[model samples]
Target: MSFEERDHTADILMHIRAADTIGLFTDAGHALMKTMYRGPARPIEEVSVTITGQSLEHLLHGFLSELLFESEVQNIVFCEFEFQIRDGEVRAILRGEPFDPAIHGGGTEVKGISWYGLSIRQEQNEYACDVLFDV
Candidate 1:
């Protein structure tokens, strides 16, 4: 399926009747990751996972956080991430490989989730969220 940039930014949306509860849309920014990752360019392996929720911001944070945590635990690092949301359902495709322990920050470890300074807002057609992940 061909997709055009919905906007200069990565925020994605689609137009469909409200009844189209099962619609699917893909963002170009996400499509690029299919071939390789970004931070240091690595071949992609698996690129598909689904997420369901109510708030977009919440879902996004949870999804990305889970991916990063999994990567750290499994010693897998990916540079690119593609996200798709429909009817509050999210699908993510991650591409990358497990990098050496030395590649990451010095003495860093995935602790757990945190509530400190967590925030998300959508105003005047703009949306943004901030999540603090424990190290």
Candidate 2:
């Protein structure tokens, strides 16, 4: 799993790649965490969520948006995840600890996932996408 960031005018553009569906989404989650928080994130708490979307791009957007919302509301930075997708439904188990400024702060504040360049594609054995994150 790998992702790279490009500086946009006022936001961050990320291109993520992985070998499979699970890795693609998993790395995307990590990308979000890496953009928003930097710390020794441990699995102190576990949370589960279900999200539905019409397509893979929608699912990815919803998943990332949900992570941002969860971090703000729960004061957590999720670093671990288990994802399962079927029939346009996604189930995820997220694990991380509550936010601590001393440990989990000081990264770029990602306001939201942008829709402008959001896309997903698969080629042979790899999956990749371009995500523009609003900062």
Stretches of model 2 off by over 4 angstroms after superposition:
none
C-alpha TM-scores of all predictions: 0.57, 0.95
Taking the candidates one at a time, how many backbone clashes does each contain? 0, 1
The alpha-carbon RMSD values of the candidates against the true structure, listed in the order shown, are 9.8, 1.0
Please report how far candidate 1 places residue 96 from its true position, in Å: 1.0
Which candidate has the highest TM-score of all? 2
Full-model lDDT, candidate 2: 0.89
Please give, for residues 1-135, the per-residue lDDT of candidate 2 as tens digits: 599987788888888889988899999899989989987899989889899999988999999999889988888889899999997999999999988899987898988999977878887889989888788
Error of 1 at 69 (Å): 3.6
Q: How close is candidate 2 to the true structure, as a TM-score?
A: 0.95
Q: Model 1: what TM-score?
A: 0.57
Candidate with best lDDT: 2
